[model samples]
Target: MKRILIINPFGIGDVLFTTPVIRALKENLPDSFICYWTNERVRYLLEHNPQIDKIFGLSRGDIKKICSKSRLRGFGALCGLLRNLRKEGFDIAIDFSLDHRYGLISRLIGIKKRIGFDYKNRGRFLTDKIRIDGYADRHVVEYNLDLLGLLNLTPPASRNLELIVSDEEKEKARELLFKAGIYERDLKIGIAPGAGASWGRDAVLKHWPPKNFAYLADKLIEEFNSKIVILGDAIEKSIAEEINGAMAHKAIDLTGATDLRELAAIISCLDILVANDGGPLHMAVALGIKTVSIFGPVDPVVYGPYPVSPKHIVLKKDLSCRPCYKKFKTPVCLRDKECIKSITISDVFDAVRRLL
Candidate 1:
């Protein structure tokens, strides 16, 4: 049986974008062994996927943490990881990292066929590559599926995002919701007021004002009697609290309360998710839940909900400088992110109402 390794050391949204590729690989090559290489934080997202036979997790933070103590030990750790991969005897490697490091590692490990995108000539070690300036004009999933042409494979008709949530996780999520005073009859609407950690300190640029979220939540409660539940990492607890503080109605704050798997489970229980462009937005799409996502610098066409439908509503400005985030970079904004800030609560509320 042929062994294949897929390399993608990105955040949740970027990593999730590659799911269609994984599904296509397993369907076309049922007997082949498929392994994934990702960061430790998102390992939970892939652990339950039956299409993936094994997973290797090593983050840059892991090496940096070791190096801070001893450079020699850090070197040894990297070498040890390489040794494990070399022993795997992988015949093919599909690299989605857009970096030369993974391609070089695949070659050093004796992989014959290395395929990836040649972004800005970074795929020098790749045996086969598609040259591109950046993710524009088409969705990222389509770009990922295009890589399959080198292997003489065609994408499946169904290109939905795949996320496998276990039965136990679903039960745990339901229990948590029950404890939060949410029941089966409640019209549950989840809101993520903070942008995800992918943007780090600059995440604020992607955020629609917290006051807007507060107003929208209150409006939803008044109109639909919706139970507002806040979702985010622990670091974003303050932002969630700010939204709750501004709103006359109260919301259950679950920031940093659940792990990644539980987060997915909680999202699955929601009737609708209103969030900024980030991981949770994509998670809701994968779970087949409706989403009304806000996009600012990033182009929704390139990174928005896959298989766009009426079920998913995207809110974005049509300014010329709106989609400044292109080619994997976001230029400094002179307008102070008016692209996202200009979006009013009424706009989002109307979109959510239409979806509901």
Candidate 2:
């Protein structure tokens, strides 16, 4: 194939997980030009990806507007995207979304070969369709890589993500830490205070109580004598600040203070990370930093830490509705969020101490 397109319309963690697929494709077909289409907010995660020739970002705001406005706008944007694809003359298009929408988009683009999962309403439009085994306990990375097998490509030996950090980004992160009064030699623990953007009260409830986090922070300080760094985007600044505000031991609130690359750089330097099951957890795993990730509604087995080893610890309670992965209109349980609340600050503190 002279040109290829890989579609991943999701958040930072999804983008990171899919990088191994991109790397496999590049390794198999070195001469082909590969491009990725992803959400605009997280396109930064793919910067300096050697496998990708170009990255296309779809604006969420524009998508929202298109859905709200005349249907013509959405179709117009699709047509524009199709025209762009035609101009590039891609020989193969892969709908990694594994959903009907991306499958339909691949068909509309009219690439010579389209490949994706054989989901409901998905086989009609593609040249290659692979039926998932419907096997239990399969990870998402494994599912995504199965697409390559349909193309007669062998699966790579391992699944891992590589995030590129520029020299400039490293310097900037160093400056940020320096300003925060952290020295290079000091032992540090990183904390991700907020989960990813979510839909309703479920989103707010996913977080551990601020008091719980503060309690852990104080214990880490008193026990380990470690400096704490709270990581988040601007949207989560308030949450990070809330945890910081409640803590008697001061934490370096780096929320909204750095971009993705800088955040990765800062996280990589840390001795350990304590976080919710979110993007920062993924970053910590990729950077080979020890992390203790707290999970409530989500199952750690499916989207858990990569390069699984002793360094990574996932804590969760076993509940009937524990794996309520998607955000629901109503609460998953009668107790609202017993899973998260049951995860005591002492549990987290003990995990961090052991990891350290």
Candidate 3:
């Protein structure tokens, strides 16, 4: 079978954004089998994609895994993977990863046609190197899709988020919600408090404060008759718990409790999700949930919420430093996150009122 390999090697949000390119490739080349390479943690995001023939997860999960013997094993695995692809005589190798590793590997494997961006440290290896033209000042999904222009492919001008929720996943979410005493009739709201990096804390401040979120939960319970749910990783559980503790009504804290798949499933059922501009926000959008994401420091124009369906919102502050982080890193700020802090609890509550 003719084959194509797409290397993303990035975050959950980036992987979600790349799904459109995968879809476009499949639509254009229906006969060529396509595969993806990404981190193990993000594998669930692409599960059940009709266009993907397979998904390979890399080994680097945490800091220790990178330092252990697993590193050597992973390198060997990567080589073996490349060799196996060579044996298949793959027709094309596309490095969607914004890094040199995949580009160099694509070159090493000697695919018939290697494709990548004309960017720093990796342009020489690709047979097709497309330059990124004035595309950074927009949502990442659009930026990723722009790469398809390299192949003369014009995808439908639509924002789409892809994910597969099986019966098993739905059942699991149902049981979890049932166990949490959340009934179908209760208005369900989801909140994500963690961001990708602490540098993006400006975005966090733009978010409704923990106490403010707590107050909103209280209002939702009293006025809207809503039940709240908080989502995050282990690191953000403490924050979720703190918010839950302060609330007048009880909320199910799923932070650190659900894996990526289960998290997606559970979020799919929510009436709405509130989050900072980050992975969970993207995930909620993919699931077709009404999500309100707060943005500060970083440019929302480049990473704003674009619900694949019709129900999502992004709240951004107007400031000169709105997008100071050019490369997704923390900026050396003169003011300590004033851009985000300027956004108040009232702003988020008003949005929730509108969305809910």
Candidate 4:
């Protein structure tokens, strides 16, 4: 294929999962142009990526409209997006987003080869569908790379994910920290309290609560003498504020302040990152930074840190319905997210201590 378009207009972590496939495509099909389409907020995730030739940002507003109750607005926006994709004359279209809209749009745009997961038989919309039962007990990186099977090509040995942060970005990240009075001597702990599935959908769903994070931050400050920084987009500033407000020791709140690349660079400077099972956790793992992740509703097997390095530690409660996040957009848990509630501050404290 001369022109390949990967549609992954979703969360930052999901976009990161496709990095290996991008590298494989660039190495195996060296001459082809690979275009990455993702949420506008996450375009920075791919801009410096050497494997991807072009990074296209999809509007968050349009995506919300497409997923919202307003059918007329959603359909109109989808049609416009469909026309735009058709105009690109893509030789191959891959829908890593797994949302039916992108798969349907690929089909409607007349792409000969469209690939995606066939969850709940959405295979009707995708030309080449790979089916997997409930959440596959494997890392999401391997799951995303499975799409490459459509070309009858085997994956390369080195599946190391890539994120290119320029030296300039590194300098800026240091500057931001320096200005915050966080010297090089201080141990930095980054806390990303927001997840797209959690905050955008339901705060109580896939998230480990704000109070827990607040308590954890205080414990780190008191015990480890670590400087904490809360990371998230503007939409999550309120959540960040809640955590910061509840904390005894003040944390540098960079929520709604840094862009995606900036966030990546900042994360690179962290001694260890502590976060919920979401984007920032994946970002830290990819950057090769030590991370302590709190898992509740989501299964650690599916979304946990890949390559299972000692640097990445996941703390999850043992429960029969631990992965209830998979059952519905909002979990159907009767005990009010007891899975997350059960994971005490001491549990996370122990995990962070091990990494520190």
Candidate 5:
């Protein structure tokens, strides 16, 4: 049996973009054992996917955390992870990480065939690669599927993002909603105001004003009698609070309340998710829930909802410098984020209305 390893040490959206590739691999090579290597934080997202036979999680932050506690333990941990990969005897590795470090590690682990993108000439160690400057022309899902061609594998016709939500997760979400006083009959709408952990400190650059979100939530409540829930991580509780503070009506604050899997569960229970371009927005799309996503510097064509269907509405301003986020880099905006800030509340509310 062939052992194939897929490496993508990135955020939730980047990893989810590879789901179609995983599905294609499983369909074409049913007997192959597929292992996914990702950041520990995002490992939960792939836990329920049956196509992935095994998952290995390791990140620099994990190593740093361990090293901070004990240097010897950290070194041993790295060695142990590398040793385990060697023992797995993986034949081919499909790497989505543009970093050369993953390619070097795959080589050291004795993987014979390495396939990936040669971004900035980082694929020097890759045996076969497609050279590109960045994800500019097409959706990331299409870019990921392109790597399959190197293996002589046919890409799946349907390239929809895949996320498997367990039955237990669904039940837990229901319980959380019930406790929040959101009944089954209530029209549930989720708003994720944060830009996700991937953007780090620059997350604020992607955020529409919290006051705008507050106004939009109140409008949604008034028009549809919707139960709005503020969704985000613990770090984003302040943003949620700000939205709550500025709002005319109260919203169920769930920021920092659920883990990544539970967040998916909660999003699954929502009729529609209105979010800035980030992980939660993609999660909703993966779960087949409608989404009205706000885009700032990022281009919706390259990173928007995968299928370009009516179920997903993208709200953005048409400006030359708007999609400043190109080739995985965003330049400092001098326009005070006019791209995102220009997207009026009415525009977003109308998009949400279309989806609802």
Candidate 6:
């Protein structure tokens, strides 16, 4: 195919997971023009990807403006987006996310070859459906690469994720940290205190408590003299405040200030990153920074630290109900979300100490 479109319109971590396929496609078909479709918010992450030639992003703010209070407006806005997408003239379309919306978009865009998984009843819209075998147990990167099987391409053995951050961005990160009182001799540890952007309270399922994070930061500061920096998007600014507020020695909050490249640059300078199962954790791992990953409702086997990386550490509470979040979109809790609640500060403290 001379032109290919890869669709993954969701969270930052899921989009990052698709990079392996992007890398493989470029390696196997260097001449092809690849366009990745993702949300407007995450456009920065993929903007610099060398494997892909173009990016098709749907701006959330424009959608909000078009469909603010009307159902018909929402439908019309979607129609406009689909109509615009159809004009792109893609030779093939691959949907990493198993959403029928993406599949239907591919179909309506008139791509001759469409590929996606059979989950969520999306096979009806796809010309090819790859059956997900024991998917819940497999790493998402593997599953993303499997879609390449449709093109008669074997999955590459090396699944090391890569994101290119410019040297200028690195300088920006150092300047930011320096202004926050981080000296060259100081040990830098990053804390991701929140999950990806969510609209409602159900987002609580994926987050560790702020107090626990505060306690862990305090311990790191007291024991190692580590300079704590809380990193996240604007949505997480409150979370940073909550964590820093609870701690005796406050962390430097960089939430809402950094974009994706700057975020990667910030992560590149860190000695270690401590976070829940989310985007920053994957980014840190990809950047080759040591990380202490905290697991609660999600299964670490599928989404934890890359097993091959020796520097990464995973801290999890082995509750029977854990991996409690299904499809990671919502929770399947029995009653209380003890999976997250049961993971104590002491548990995380011990893990951080080992990393330090």
> What is residue 286's positional error in candidate 4, in angstroms?
1.6
- Backbone clashes in each candidate structure, one number apiece? 0, 0, 1, 0, 0, 0
Candidate 1 TM-score, true structure as reference: 0.97
Name the candidate, 2 or 4, with the larger lDDT value.
4
How well is each residue in 198-276 modelled by candidate 4, as lDDT tens digits?
3465654667889999999999999989999999878889999999899888999999898888999999999999888
Span of 10 residues, lowest total lDDT, candidate 5 = 195-204
Alpha-carbon runs more than 4 Å astray in model 1: 69-72
Q: TM-score: which candidate is best?
A: 5
- Candidate 5, superposed: residue stretches over 4 Å from native: none
lDDT of each: 0.91, 0.78, 0.75, 0.81, 0.93, 0.80
Top-lDDT candidate index: 5
TM-score of 6: 0.91
Instruction: Please provide the root mean square deviation of candidate 3 (C-alpha atoms, Å).
Output: 2.7
Candidate 4 lDDT at 229 equals 95
Model 4 deviation from native, Cα RMSD in Å: 2.9
**Order of quality (lDDT):** 5, 1, 4, 6, 2, 3
What's model 2's TM-score? Answer: 0.90
Model 3 residue 348 lDDT score: 75
Error of 3 at 124 (Å): 2.4
The residue pairs found clashing in candidate 1 are none
Q: Could you tell which candidate, 2 or 3, scores higher by lDDT?
A: 2
Q: Where does candidate 6 stray beyond 4 Å?
A: 59-65, 69-84, 327-335
| Cα lDDT tens digits for candidate 3, 17-121 | 888788788777788798887777787788877889988777234323653767776667666666776666667877766566667777777776777776655
For model 3, what is the alpha-carbon lDDT of residue 237?
A: 81
- Candidate 1 CA-lDDT value: 0.91
